[model samples]
Target: MEQTPLEIQLKTLPESPGVYQFFDREGKMLYVGKAKSLKKRVSSYFNKRLENGKTRVLVGKIDSIRHIVVRTESDALLLENNLIKEHQPRYNILLRDDKTYPWLCIKNERFPRIFPTRKRIEDGSEYFGPYTQMRTVRALLDLIRSVYPLRTCNYDLSEEKVAAGKYKKCLEYHLGNCLAPCEGLQDEASYHNQVDDIREIIKGNFGASLTYFRHRMKELAVEMAFEQAQAIKEKIEILENYQAKSTVVNPKIDQVDVFSIVSDPTHAYVNFMQVSHGLVVRSHTMEIKKKLEEADADLLPLAILELRERFNSDTRELYLPFPVSLPEDLKVVVPQKGDKRKLVEFSERNARFYRQDRFKQIRIIDPDRHVKRLMQQMKTDLRLSEEPRHIECFDNSNIQGSNPVAACVVFRDGKPAKKEYRHFNIKTVEGPDDFASMTEVVHRRYRRLLQEGESLPQLIVIDGGKGQLSAALKSLDELSLRGTIAIIGIAKRLEEIYFPGDPIPLYLDKKSETLRVIQQLRNEAHRFGITHHRNRRSKSAISSVLEGIDGIGEKTARDLLRKFKSVKRIRQASVDDLAEVVGPSRARKVYESLRE
Candidate 1:
């Protein structure tokens, strides 16, 4: 709730990129919002009486307000994502996309194979099609088999059929699902040609391939090779199937996204759906808290731009957050007729439902309270030019002797600075010396930023107090980068803060919420950096064993390690199973070498 008399509050807020909070009486948070031009957007709320139910409820509790100006909308979006996650404000219609989309995976090997999966694996396989629909994935797999049935079984060829002969042809081959080239029933020369055809179809040049295949079909028939001609016909049919589905997409659109916004006075719910390659992939929601008395002309463009930034756009499309007069660059689409217009009504309804159903829990929190008190103590204790506006935090994570990763998260004006968040793979630091790790990350992060001519943070937050702080400070000093950045290390328990050159942890005034907020940012950065490091470490530990095995060169080791992520799992596999993965008859040797 904007606490101040609406007019005065509007004047007080600056017109810049930043986040603002509305508070009710008792200093409780009523709502939170970010904007490119705070003055314009915040002022608009006070100027007009919100007829929207949501706004009315939020406005009724107006009390006090605060603002934190930022640099860009990208920076603003990052802050918004982090805030929404941390606060879970009642009024925000959050889009929690826990559902990882399914995609097609083609194992990268001497003879690569294609398939579908919902889980993402960091393996030596080429992955494609994070297609939103399961049906879309299945359809492609079915088409691949019908058109050019490649191996679909996850079998150990060494134990299954390789021992019988170099190539005895599997069941699919005898059944005509496969070309039987393995058994030499179908010549390798001819089978390679079929593989070429399959590759072309997957690449989306179906029409040209279909035409070329048609000629092949006719030629086969002229030679009285009826079976070969029939195979060609099947491939053509698969191509046609894909085209028919894509035909539903309105040609006039090329590609487009339809969005609608339904908001009450307190919070605005922007509901959106995207259309690509003539199909709808997903729908998402953007939540904005009640506006303050500042102006708003920049909100619409920023919202749409953020939406665009989050998704892919290799295919041209329009992403509308409302029934907007499409901008010139947006391809200004007004679907007056046909299939395109029909979609508009459905999108519009989602918009309406989204608007009305945006039941949000609004809490106005003044982070400034905690941050200000902490800054004051720091000022009196060590003294500074001003309260820190931008604080950069660093942490390192890794398993014992494994893949190590580091993360740097920034907080600007008490809000997260996402555009500046960075990750690093631990290098040069041999063992898990937490100090050395922090030093490496700090050095790498700052050196690169300076080289790139990026803005430096006003303050630095190290995850640990004392030792970690000393390591980071010393690292910066060695690089001649220490003085400008105000350094502080936050101790976890009791939330103690240790500033540079101080052995004792500093305690801040209890009333300052900004201090607590900064501590939270530092802790979160530590958590994030460690989780990434652990994941990399686990993968590295698994990858290392393959390299140690004799005869397993980089590519081969990568292929095996990728297929089975860990050495323990591979160790449990029988010789036959191992052989099947790499080739025929090598499983015994592989098993022996890996065990050694």
Candidate 2:
């Protein structure tokens, strides 16, 4: 066989680490991939038999290939991630939630101000974290404020200005939130000491501040300054409390980045934890959607690079669930025992939890996707040949053999299709015979659909036990539709499901989506039936009361009820108002009867 243009291009590729692109006949980019060896990776597409069907299909559409050589695998990884983000090729892993997390900044100046920021600039300032939440940042800032009287104003507290006394103390100074550094009331050395303590605390090291306060308290106590010593004791307590709340691990495991990933057929969730002095100073979880069948190994390394850059992480040591290919300068440790192992497990748990939470949120926000998943689940659980996209549930409602009626609630794509619902008056059934009423309604519903040439439901659910199910089958038999439509009956007790010929009930898990959807349909049908039954009883009561009068008939009674809304309202109406509704003679009779 002659080599194609793609094969020739692949043969000419270099052995160095690089990024590769596949394009189709129409010059549309099909996929983007990174490899340690350009020639080896590009040739493998043609030499190796790809297991994933999606990859095989993608390969078949490849009309040409391109490559960009890089200095190292890490460089290739970064370039690939960037290209995937920019082009969003059909066969690259796509990250859906890639927003930058916020970091706490301490400016590099006299009387430096501290605040939370999302942007990382190249100015001479120190950044603490790209925290997962703003709430965490705020809580840390509050703790710092309580412990130290730091200035909150954005002022240029230069040495010259302070010497000249160019500025005055503001509200923060009077409120005790600041030490009035602008007015030269605060000592430069003391303010710088406080700033150093704050830097240590933010780095997850509280020992320095605690030691300083303890020494200060000892000195104050020795000098017989009891009041100042007491104040220093309180400050120590606040710092210790804040430290206790923040620490989650042993202090020995310091200055490391932790990563763990959880993936499915179509997506991967990666969770990152930045540990400093055994405390989780920063944590985040990101979700990536796979356009191709990419594994966790392929996705995690790229994600680590992106997240590290985004968070401005500088830790050289990393704790991961598994070893990944990274730059030689970085140390990767796959912990198997002790606190490090536990930290890895914790990161994995976070990733799993985040994946589950993201799925739940998606179901809530995207109803169509939720319904599609439910329908597919129902199809598998029930062993149906096709998805039950259109389902109709029948329920009978009656009050002690009076006002018997039935309701059929239609669900299209796992949601209540209200307009497709119907109410039946139990025309052929006597008394409150539920089984007979179900049969009559089923027959009437499908018979009319067949006559009108309308589409039929994929599944029929009768809200009763085997007897009611058999009755509904009888209607389908009459219509020559038995075994053509999927039918089941749900017993109210224990929520058992009955089929046509099976004597044993099929009991689904109580928390299964199929069972929940069935229950929703049954409840909706019952509610709909009860409403119609109530209306029928009220109408019958009004008709009987009005027809008892001498001059009134059935139609006249209906007209009177329709015009006045109810019998009480009709009775409340004046004789002239009643005359306009039911005419002169009947109005007089009605008015007199009510009055008497």
Candidate 3:
């Protein structure tokens, strides 16, 4: 058989690191990917069966392939990221942060004036940030102004212009906020020195500024200028306070970027923390809209490059939640213990919180999208064939083998459907046989649903361990619905989830939304079962005590009990009092029965 052009291309491709682009029939880019071996990676699309539906579709749409060989895997990663952004292939994840972050720019001038800006120009001016929050920029600016008193006006403070006395200080000079640098009241050298200190502070290095202020304060105190010394003291306090608030870990840990990611089926949230001298100077959580079912390993690198570029972070050191491919020159630490690990965990917490907040907002604004995302998350977590939009949980309740009953609680769209809840009395299986009771209820519940032509639940939760799960499976097998509905059992002690024939249980994270929902279902079922069990026990006791008497029927017993709220009170009631409720003939019989 003759080989096709794609097969020939795949065979002839280099085994080196490279980026590959997939194009559709009409020459539109479908997807862009990076690989350590172009021959193996690109060939994988045709050779392997892609599990992700979107990836399978993307592969089906590919008409031609192109490759750009790189020297190293890291170079290939960077190129793939750049190509994805440049062309925005249909099957690539998109970094969704479009907000204009504020930066502290030091204007290019004789006496540089520093201010916050949203734009960066190609002039020789220095821009410190591209910070994640405007408030941080403002606070830094306010701190620098209070301590340094630099000029706010963007005047041409040239030497000749100042010598010619072409400018005058405004109310800023009167208020002592500026030293009148425009009028040469402050010298060029002194203003430049202040600018140097401000630059250090913006880089999250407060040592230079703090040392300068402390030295000045000492000089003023030595000269018996107590008021000026106190003023310097206040400036030192401000710098020290800000540094204290910003610093998070060991001050020796400097120039490192921390990245952590939390993701769902539709989106991924990546938190970036720019650490300088252990201070988290800039922290941001960005959401990425997934075009395919991208994993964390794929999404993290793209986000790392995009965020580092956007924030102008040149730090070669990174603290991440997991290992990833990057340039050999860059240090990547997947911290396992101690402060570095704590920092990574902190970033992870921020990403999770951001994801939850987005969920809350979406739930309020667009409930359908929120529900869809939640269902998708649950489906993935539980390894289900489809979304568990309608779920049922079963629990058996019996105290001392008396009133053995089962309660089935229904949840529609993650909320309890109270009207659909049903309770069952133990018919064939008696005593405290939880497993048998579970089998009977599950069999009966679905048997009726099948008989009535009602829809079955996507998931069934049995609130017990392997034994109960096995019992429930037997019922499903009898109904021939074993493969039709997904079922799992939850153990109460460890919150372990068990599947049929799978001995090893799955333990979800304590904070997982899926575990929370499962717990809610289990607890509701238990509560409902306990309530029904208690009611049955009360009714049985009443029947045994009152209905056991001869010639005292259920109606007379009910009438007597209604008049006296409790069985004990009914026993204490006089014959005349009982007659007022029931007739005198039945009243005497009831009175005699109570004494007995």
Question: What Cα-based lDDT does every candidate model obtain?
Answer: 0.63, 0.82, 0.83
TM-score of each: 0.35, 0.45, 0.57
The most accurate candidate by TM-score is: 3
lDDT of 2 at 236: 88
lDDT of 1 by residue, 227-334 (tens): 989978887776876732222233234357665555433345555556643344435557666455222233545556677677654334554433444346565455
State the TM-score for model 1. Answer: 0.35
Could you tell me the lDDT of residue 570 within candidate 3? 88
Candidate 2, residues 471-543: lDDT per residue as tens digits?
Answer: 9999999999987789999999999999889999999989676899999999999999999989899889989
lDDT of 3 by residue, 500-552 (tens): 98999999999888999999999999999999999999978987788888887
Q: Against the true structure, candidate 2 has what lDDT? A: 0.82
Query: Which candidate tops lDDT?
Result: 3
How many pairs of residues collide in model 1?
A: 43
Clashing pairs in 3: none
Once fitted onto the true fold, the runs of candidate 1 whose alpha carbons sit more than 4 angstroms away are 1-383, 398-405, 561-588, 591-596
